[model samples]
Target chain A: MPRRDPAAFAEFVAARSPALHRAAYLMVGERQLAQDLLQESLTKTYVAWPRLRDHGKAEAYTRKVITTTAITWYRRRSWNAERPTESLPDTVAGGHDDAVTQREWLWTALQELPPRQRAAIVLRFYEDLTEAQTAEAMDCAVGTVKSQVSAGLAKLRDRLGDRFGEHADDLLPPTLMVVTP
Target chain B: MTELLKDTMDQAADSLLAPDLDVQAMVREGDRRVGRRRTAVVGAGVAAAVVAAIAVPSLLPQDQQRATEPVGFAAVFEAHQPSWATGSEVHVGGRSFDAGHQVFAYVQTTEGVVFSDPSGQVWASNGTQTVGVGRTDAEHPRLEADGSRVAWTTYGDGRPTEFTVYDQATGEVDGLAAQTGDAEVLALDGTDVYARDGREIVRWSLATGTRTSLGRPTGIEIEDVKAGVIAHQLPHADDGATSPYFGRELGETLAPDFYQTLALSPDGTTALGESEADVPALADTATGAVTPITVPGYGFFVGFGWVDDDTYVGLGVNEPYQTTPLDLLECEVGGTCTVTAEAIGSAASGVVLPFGQSMDD
Candidate 1:
C-alpha cells in the first residue's frame, strides 16, 4: 500500500473545508456540531486517503462520511436529547422581513426532519446531486432516496402551509411542489 | 419549489462563516486511528498464529474427535459463505447447498438447515432435498433454532400474533398462539420461547401452553434472552444514556455502556458488548467482568450471535467509513477470531447470519 501524502491531504482540506462545513452546518443545524462533524469526517478521509486512489473524489467521500456520520449521531439518544432549542429572532432588525422569516422557518423545518430525510434533502437540493448519487452517499437504495426526499419535501410544505397559509405555494420552488404533490 | 429550496439552503449555508480548518489536529487523529487499527490487526494475527501452532494438534485426534463430539448447536456456527455470495447459497459444516430461493435467515440442525426466504417462507434443506416448512410475515420476521427445533414468530395485521416451532426430527410444526397480540419472539431455549410483549418480557412454555411474565414492566426494551436469562436496556435517562441489565433483577447494571447491538450467549453465561474501540467484549453475566476480544483487520463489529456457549460470530467491517467488504468473523470469548468468510458483501447485500438477524435487519 502507498503511504498517504500529508501535504496533499492538507491541501484538500484547505480547499474543501468551506463547502463541506457549510453542508455540515445545514445537516446538523448547529455551528459547533457542524464544525465537529466536519473535523471528524476530515480525519476519516485522511485515514482513507491512501485507498482513495484518486484524490479528485476526496470531496465526494468526505460528503458521504459527513452524511453517514451525521445520521449515526442523530440516531443516538444522547444527540437528540442534547439538541439545543432553536430561538428565532423575534423582530426583523434589518429590512427584507418576509425573506428573513421564510429563511428562519425553512431552516427550522429542515432541522425538524428525521436524520435520513434531512440528509437526503441536503444531498439532493443543497449539494445538487442526483437521486442515485444521493443514495450512494447515504448508503441506501435509489428508491429509498426518492421516498426520503419526497417525505422531507412534503413535510416542509405541510409546515410552510400551516404557517404561511395560501402563500405556501409561492414560497416553495415549482419543481418541489410538483414532485411532492 | 426546487429552485427556492436550493437557493434557501445555499443562502443559509453561506451565511455561516466557515470554522478554521484544523489540518494538524485532523492529521494527528487520523494517524492515531490508523496506528490503533494496525496494532490490533498485527496483535490478533500474532495471537491466532500462536494458537494454531501450539493448540491445534494437541487438543484431539481427528478420528477420536469425530466419534466423541455430538452434532448440535456447534454445527450452526460452521455455516458461512464467502462475503460475495448471493442469498441463494447456504454453507454449513464444510458443505454447500442451494436453497433455490434467496435465504434471509437460517440455522443448521442435525437433520438439515432450516431457513427463511425474503418472502418469509420457511424451508429445510438436507444436502440432497429441500422442503418448505412454513411461512411468517415477510417484513422483519424473526427465526431462532436450538437443539432439534426451529422457532419463528408469525405476524397478523402487521403485529406478531403467534409463534411456530418446527421439529426437524419428526418433521412436525407446532403453532402456539401468543398470549398477547403484539409479542415478538426473542430467543428459543428448548421448550421455552422467550418474547417481548410491549415493555415486558414474557416466557411461553411450548409443552404446557402457558405464559409467564418474567418481571414487572417498566417500559424496558428486551435485547436478547437465553435460558431464563434476559438482557434488556432501561428507558433513556435524562442525559440520554441507557444502561444494560441482565436477568429480572434490573437494579444492577451489567456494563457501563454498550453500543447499539447486544446479544447473550446461548447458555446465558456471557454477553457480547461492543467496546469503545469497536471490538466485541465478552461480559460475564454474573460477575460483570468484560473482556475485549481482538479481531484482525476490522474496524467495527456488529450483529453478534453465539454459536455455542463460549464462541460468538458477528459481521466485521474492515473500514467503518466505507460500508463494503464485510467479513463474517467467529471469535471465542477469551480467544482470537478467524475470518470465517471474507467479502461477504456490504450492509445492503441482504446477507444474513444465523445470529444477529435483528441487527442485520
Candidate 2:
C-alpha cells in the first residue's frame, strides 16, 4: 500500500489468486463465475489498498470479501453444482481409487448444503481458520459458525455415510504448511 | 483428522482449477484501472472547461447575472462505482477470450454498453462486467438498446433476416422472425421493431408481434429509429435532400452541414453528430447551434454513445482510427471529458478495430 511499492499489491494478488480461485470455486461451484468473483473482490481490495494497515491482513480481507460477496450473490443467482459421474475419472482404468472416490463424493455433497453452512465448513476445515476466525470471516457469532460446521458435516456424513468422518485430518488446510514462526 | 480432511479439500480445489493463469494481465488490468482513476480526476478539470464554455450555454444558461455560477455536466451518479472499479474477462462459448478482440458499435444500456462482433455475436460491458448474446451474420448489423433490452438483426445465409434480442437483467435471449423477403431491420426502440419491406416502412411490436404500417410508400426512406426518434431522408421531389431527419415526431431535419447524427440523448433533444470539424460535436436539434466536443487528451475521431440524458461514453480511436485502446471516455453535458485508457493511439492501447465505422455511422 506504500506509495513507493505498488508492486507489493500486485505480488500479493498474483501469489494468492490461485488459492482464492479454489476457495471461490468451492463456494460458487463454477470456474468462470469463481474467477469473476475473485477478480471483482480483488479489484475492490486493490481500490482500498491504501487504507489497509497491515499488509499481512490482505489475504484475510480478500477472504472476507470472497465469503460475503459469494453469500450476497446467492439471493440473485444459484450456482450449479458439479455432479460426480458414476464412472471414474479417465486416469484410472475401469475403477476409481477409494480415497479419490470418497473425496469426489464429498465435493458433490458439499455443494448441496445451503451457502452459509458450506462457507462455514470451507472456512473452518478447508481454509484452516478456527471457529472464531471463521465467525469473523462469515461475520457471524462463534456459535453460528460451530452449528453451521456441525450441520454441514452432518449432511456430508448423511450423504457419504461413516466414511466421511474417517478423513477428519484431511480437513486441515495444506496452505498452512508455508507459514513459519 | 483435520489434516486428513484438508487433503481432500486441497485435491478437490486442484480438480476444479486450471494449471496456468496469467496473473500479470489481470494485475496490470487492475492497475491500469487505478491509474485511470487518478489521471481522469486530473484531466477532467481542463476538459470540463473546454466543454462548459461551449455546452453550458446549450444545456444551461450563462446569463450575466449568473456569470459567477459554476456550470458543468452532472449526472445522478449517487453511489455509482467509478468507471475504473469494474473489469471482466471476455467469454465466448463458455470459454474466456484470452487476448480476445474488443467489441464495437455499442449502445448504452441500463447496466453497460452493448456491442456486436463480425459474426453477429454481441457482448455487453460497463467497464468490469461482460456477457455475450447469440450470433448474427447480417453484414452492417445494427445494434439498439433501451436499458437492459438489446436487439440486432441476423442473416441466415441471406434468407429470412432475423432479429436477436437480449435482456441483461433477466439473462434471457429471444429471437423475432422479422421478414423472409428482401427487407432490412433498421433499429429497435423499446418493444417496437422498425423494418423495411420493399419501400413500405413497418413498425412491428417485439412483444406482441403485431405489425403497424407507419407511412404509405413514398419517396422518403427510413434511415434509423430509436425510442420513437426517426432519422430518414425526405422524398427527392426537391432535388433530394442529403441530410437525414432527426428527433421524435420526426420534426427537425438534418442540415446539409452536419455529418449525420450517430446517437441521441434519451429525451431526443440533443444529437451526437459529426460536423465539418474533424472531431464529433453535439448539435442542438431545437436551435441551429452546434458545439464541437473533444476528448481532453486524445484528438482522434472516436466512437460515442449516450449514457444518460446528461452524460455520454466515448471510445478513443488512434490516428487512422484502427485501434480502440479500450480507453473509456466519460463526458457530461456541461463539463469536460476524461478517458480511462492508459494512452491514446499507442500500440498497447485498446483492442484492434480492424474494420472501423465512421463517427457518423
Identify the candidate with maximal lDDT: 1
Q: What are the per-residue Cα lDDT tens digits for candidate 1 across B148-205?
A: 5667777776654777777655566666677677667776666677777655677777
> lDDT tens digits, residues B108-164, model 2?
444434566555556654334445555554245456555455666666674576666
TM per candidate comes to 0.51, 0.42
Give the alpha-carbon lDDT of every model.
Answer: 0.64, 0.53
- Worst lDDT run of 10 residues, candidate 2 chain B, spans B43-52
**Alpha-carbon shift of residue B19 in model 2 (angstroms):** 65
TM-score of 2: 0.42
- Cα error of candidate 2 at position A133, Å: 83
Best by TM-score: 1
lDDT of 1 by residue, A48-130 (tens): 67645557667887888899889988887555567984544444346387777787788788888888998999998888888
